[model samples]
Target chain A: MPDTPKRTVFYVSDGTGITAETLGHSLLAQFPEFDYDEVRAPFIDAPEKASDLVERIERVKRRTGLRPIVFSTLVQPAVVAVLHRAEAHIVDLFGTFLGPLERELGMPSTHAVGRFHGILDNRSYQRRIEAINFALSHDDGIIQDGTLDDANIILIGVSRSGKTPTSLYLAMQYAVKAANYPLIPEDFERKALPAPLKLHRAKLFGLTIAPERLAQIRQERRPNSVYASLENCRKEVEEALALMRREGIPWIDSTTKSIEEIAAVIMQHLQKMQKYADL
Target chain B: MPDTPKRTVFYVSDGTGITAETLGHSLLAQFPEFDYDEVRAPFIDAPEKASDLVERIERVKRRTGLRPIVFSTLVQPAVVAVLHRAEAHIVDLFGTFLGPLERELGMPSTHAVGRFHGILDNRSYQRRIEAINFALSHDDGIIQDGTLDDANIILIGVSRSGKTPTSLYLAMQYAVKAANYPLIPEDFERKALPAPLKLHRAKLFGLTIAPERLAQIRQERRPNSVYASLENCRKEVEEALALMRREGIPWIDSTTKSIEEIAAVIMQHLQKMQKYADL
Candidate 1:
């Protein structure tokens, strides 16, 4: 197979640039055959700033001989125009959705550049902060015995199976009070659920990983140690899966999955459980 | 003002529903004059699941006599058909971008659901995990003496002024190595930069908040205490802002800003610094 040409891509936003990058990644991921050199140009509010971005984009295009792709969420028409003047393929995210929304709502959009992620006074922001605090305090099974009642979800997994990052992502993104616990050697020896987790079985979600991948991840942290050995990884993962199966806890294989994917699955499970309980 | 009508909005996704919600929020936030009750329906991979979502949307429409808005990123054509049958507005994110992308790339997309956040094998995912780990270990200035050299950005702020969440968000989202330090009462008394932070002043970013807001936040944690008093909050913020101005360190007033906004500003600053260094 011939090598696919590398293209330059930029996520330009008047605010956090997260939404632009996220949607751009989703669009770009569809065509994984092409390699991309991605850049983030956030806080592009003024016309001057947009002109500067255009210069940067044009520079890249001239050097690469490929028209750069710009994914922008600039709400201001003037700034968007400045970016459009550049010799690139531009996707205006706000321009795409806000029109339809305005027609549906019977009003024009405020054309605000950064309203989506402003002000800590909003209820959602407060909830996210609270969730972050809860996650940090209860991380790694540091909770006092019998104090797991407040957690919306509890993650159980072998070390380096991606419980911690998943929990933090869930809390930060979704305001979910996620607590994670490592399935230690003692738990495997006991062949039973840990004492603190026994009563909260309903909230438990398990994570497992391929032994080879787990060994590689563990090796990065503890090189040349038995903890990073494939045999130990295989044993722990096998035992953890058996425990989750015996306990009827839903589990996911985290070896090839990202934290966002793992957290999403957990959230979907919780939503389903809540819906069922409500019914 | 009269009571605005409350509208129902759903973020429907074949995967995590994050992209849908993010773009939906950006659109909805433009019309904050109207109230919204938001729902997330993740993992709608099948036609049956899409049907269930339509049913829910119809139910909400019937109850309110207003059609609900559906923002979806479902990649499957059959499932998308099921959603199109619903009596509501549908914003198909993948449907919107995929065709343009496919045409540009001169190849049909794989139409793979949830590939944007699929695996941990990517360099971006690994960097994000490393950043998360770094943020956790160096949180609240817990690093040992002379150990702050690894930090890409150091945040200094009065307690609860949004430093910790901003640091974590920067790390999780942008793979930034962010370390935060709380400006304690001792620093305020000294009327000087903390000894540990003085050497790393080039990397410093300060956060300050309105005293009343700070008091309200602190009062929630420690009711009726001096630490939560408005006077103390005022004194600390004043001193912190003074220190930042005196030391010529850039700062932000975090009283109303969300963590995402703070992180964006910090990233923008970092980008400028990098560009300057390159020049």
Candidate 2:
């Protein structure tokens, strides 16, 4: 078999290019067998910047003897025209979708640059910041009086079961106030929910991980301790799972799931509960 | 003058749908005058799920008397086919870009599902989790000995200058170890950088907010206090700006920028420094 061909892929946009890069990565993931060297050309709002990027793409193409791939969300026509001159396969993201949307809405796009990720509305932006602060303050069971009352959801799991990151992601991405509590050995011994959590049972979610994975993660934090022992991990996970089942709180296994997947599952559970509440 | 048209928009995907939703929001931001009710249809990996989503979209269309717009990254051809049956204007993100990418690469895509945001590699996933942990531990100037040395970037600013959220965003989105320190009144009084920060001056980046904005943010935390007073806010911001300028540290005003934009600007600065160091 021939060696895998390598190509340079650029995610270019007038703004931060995060959206372009995210969609570009999703599309590239379909071709897992190929090799790609990815580059981000963000803040290409000016024609001069676009010209510079085109030069960079040309340099890569000449150096590798292969045409590069450019995924662009550029909104400015002049900038897009400049990028079009590159010796590459240009995937114009905004151009492809905007025309259809304009026809459907009976209005032309304003062709604005850097609007989506900017501080567009003060209220929503402040809410996001407040949510982040709430997540941080309430992380790892650091709860103050009446704080848990404001949380949209509270996550309960053993340490290293993927609570903090999930809470932060939910808050940052969706502006949902998430507070996480770690289920310690004491909770398992008592065989009851934490005092604060009992009041917010309706808003509670659980996360469990495989004992082996939990052990592996704990070993990184404290090597050769009982916390990192497989036996201890097994007991904690088993008890946590049993307790969650007994309490009828929803739970998920985070052993093989990414933070994004875990957050999405949690949001679905919240939506379902809201639907039931409306009934 | 007529009232703004209202429409339902669905971001549908086989995976988390975050990429689809993000790009969809960017597209919608162009039409700022219109009103939209947005919904996320994530994890539609099967044709049955796709069919269910189509029903939901059609119901929205029937209620609104307008075709709902769908931005989809559904990879499975069967699921995509089912989604196409909806009475909506579909923006098939994958279909539009994948064909061109395949032709450029001279290979067919595997059409796999949920690969981009999943834990594809254990090492990279671990790195991201570790970065999040680092950001949390080093947040708000809570630093241990030798901890700041591992940071990829160190953010310094007055309280509520957008350090913590930006640090968390950088860690979550880019797997970057970001440590943040608050520049306090003492630092201003001393007219010198903090001792811990002086050792790592090269990694330091500053964030400043407009005094009025800072006062507003502080009022939310500590109402009717000296810290929340506009006079104090003005003095602190002025001193922080002066100190950063004197120290030759790069800084940006966070008054109007989102976390994504702030993180993107910092990353650009880091990249430029790396390029210069290479020379």
Across residues A1-279, which tens digit of lDDT does each residue of candidate 1 receive?
956556888999998888898889888777777777878888899999998999999899888888888898899998888988999878888888889888998988888778886542277777889889988888898894349998999999999889888888888888888898999889978989999999899999999999999999899889989999999999999999998999999999987777887887887788778732321
Give the least accurate 10-residue stretch of model 1 chain A, judged by summed lDDT.
A270-279
Give lDDT tens digits, candidate 1, residues B1-279. Answer: 956456788899988888898888887888867677778888899999999989999998988888899999899899999999999988888888888877776789877888777652388778889888888888897884348888898999999998888888988888888888999989878978888888899999999999999999999989999999999999989888888898999999887778888888888788778732310
Docking class of 1: medium
State the displacement of the C-alpha of residue A153, model 1, in Å, after optimal TM-score superposition: 1.4
lDDT of 2 at B240: 97
Record all residue pairs in model 2 with backbone atoms less than 3 Å apart, i.e. clashing: none
Which regions of candidate 2 are displaced past 4 Å?
A: A1-6, A119-121, A275-279, B1-5, B119-121, B275-279
Cα displacement (angstroms), candidate 1, residue B164, comes to 1.4
Highest-TM-score candidate: 2
The superposed Cα distance between candidate 1 and the true structure at residue B167, in angstroms, equals: 1.5
